[model samples]
Target: MKRTTFLLVFGVILSFSQAQLDTGGEETGGEEEHVELFTTPATKMGAATSDFGYNLFRALASQEAATNVFLAPISVSAALTQLSMGGSEQAQRQLFRALRYHTLQDPQLHNTLKDLLASVRTPGKGLSTAARIYLSRRLRPKQDFFGLVEQQYGVRPKALSGGPKDVTEINNWVSQETGGKVQRLLTKPLPRNSGVNTVSAAYFKGKWVTRFGQSGAMENFQVDGGVPVRIPMMQQDNYPVKMGADSDLSCTIVQIQMQDDVSMFVFLPDEVTSNMTLLEESLTAEFVQDLSMTLLPAQVFLSLPALRLSYSTDLLPLLSDLGLSDWLADTDLDKISTQSAKLASLNHKVAMETVPEGNQYPSAASSAHLSYRVDRPFLYLIRDESSGALLFIGRVVNPKDLMI
Candidate 1:
């Protein structure tokens, strides 16, 4: 039998206060502000990679046992592009092709990656992006690569002397960048042959723009296509939400806005037993884009299960299988230094949660609650509404499994 495929990406953020942005509006926590991006969302590089991401998502989700899966496609691409800057011509071209940018000039790709990084790291969006690049104690990164990373990505490489002591610095930086939500990056130790290695992270969390009230009832969720298990269901009546139908997908699409211009979207098959293969087969970044942009605000009686979970993946084997074998096959990334370097491993980690609005239930706004109810296995998306940057994508086969 063909296994079902659904994709997931997640992150959880505790409240962090900073200087307020100058956008004439208070950001999260009533104090901090994010510096707006240098360019509009329409011109951002994250949008450019959506297609590539869509393809990559499907491939990653197709792996057996990935009943629930999540990965930051933009985060992964951001780090790869940075690494490519110091890679040889063939290596750079291979990287670009894998990300579906085979035709663009290097300058354009670099600029877009730079902007995409800045756009997500803006001060108050409950999202953060950071890159920690390490070089062998014996080798120094080239001055040209150093200057470019600083100028464009606003990050400087920190060289590590041999040993695991630098793990503290790496984890500390990850914690700082993720607001203490992510504590450590490596468990075993740095991968061997990690010449010019980089660790990339994207952490996102936002309270629901339209908060849900605790229904005080246990809802049933299917486990591995088996019997339903009871789980806490967050719900709201008469909430203005966007809803759509993809006849091709046989799934109903719903979009829920979260604070900070971020949105959580769900795609549910019309029936619990419906063939999700059909829905997964029709999936694409462009398809998601059109579905979201086309949803009309309607009074929705929405009910959804609360989610809290963390997941990580070693992307080396997966990426290699996806046609990036050249990078993993003892290939040389000679641009960083004449000394040979190979990306020993590429990993992505995330944490996500959806909680109530400070311990209060919302008063019902309308009578129609049947507009959308997520009762079975489904896919989810967290995205920057303005720039259409996808922050997270995930799937839920068993809601009970998602409870942290």
Candidate 2:
């Protein structure tokens, strides 16, 4: 009962407004403790129409925050609910089937991936179609889904067959993919006569297109609001400006538009030190709206101090926060069985290295690389270069983000 309740909550969040029940809310006064369930009908919707490329940026930023390898398939149940395709039960079944196929890497995984392309009804529908086709192809021999996966990540997908012991192959694949940033996850040998795992990865290596002088102006960076750190600060004046709402989160978004139409949105409180949790907890359609309305052009002699950060995290907690707990469960496997068996958990790791590419912007060029090392999670995505439509989404998040 408890597990079912939890899955229910996740289903609501992933499907977005499909459930139409208050699964999340603070109770007030003396009232009966109630469980919320989906009762309202859903409508087929398009991507956020107001914000140009909004979903694209949001998806990319989410991938950046993932410290370890991340893998998650499209929530067919959740997605279908938005499209008004079926009842919650039907959606749930579809989602489960997809999960099962990915987990077990069944040849059926290919067909399942193909079937999903037909039903997806979202903004940039064409892009979603191409992405699904690519993911299905990865399940075939000699067809590498990772290369076709489009999104930038760092992990490989593992097929679930025989038993939960194929950790070695997963680990070796991780080592090769990440260039030795992480290692060793499984505690035992893979079962004999297991099938192959299907995985996807994204790797980034970028430096400031304009390299900052090794010896440059130094200033104090507000590490934790006031906790200052004397760091190398890179100064920029009159850089190309593109602004957007960081409303999807608690922070105000500030973007530095670059060549090739790629840009980075930095998430920080309107005023630094604001509890990040405000943005973290209240992130949703309503919250994103608040931020989007407030975006405006601003001018300043911006100073971005140099800092090197490397960290990794297990995605279970964050995914749970986003209402995506099924991927981490034993029973909620994607219908990816290559044979008759299922899987345990998808695992992964990630790493990034950013440095100066060398230049003075107006005087030169600037660039950066965001690389991911995924050892466990494998489902990933890729979007259209211009339209921001989600092109591909897959899952491989187990025993793959480690260094071989």
Best by TM-score: 1
Scored by lDDT, model 1 comes in at 0.65
Indicate the residue-level lDDT of 357 in model 2. Answer: 47
| TM-scores for the candidates | 0.80, 0.44
Q: What is the C-alpha lDDT of each candidate?
A: 0.65, 0.30
Every model's Cα RMSD, please?
10.1, 14.9
lDDT of 2 by residue, 35-140 (tens): 2111111100112211211322233335554322222123222221121111134434443343222223233433333333333423222211111111121233
Superposed Cα RMSD, model 1 = 10.1
Off by over 4 Å in 1: 1-41, 64-66, 103-107, 136-140, 215-217, 273-277, 358-365
lDDT of 2: 0.30
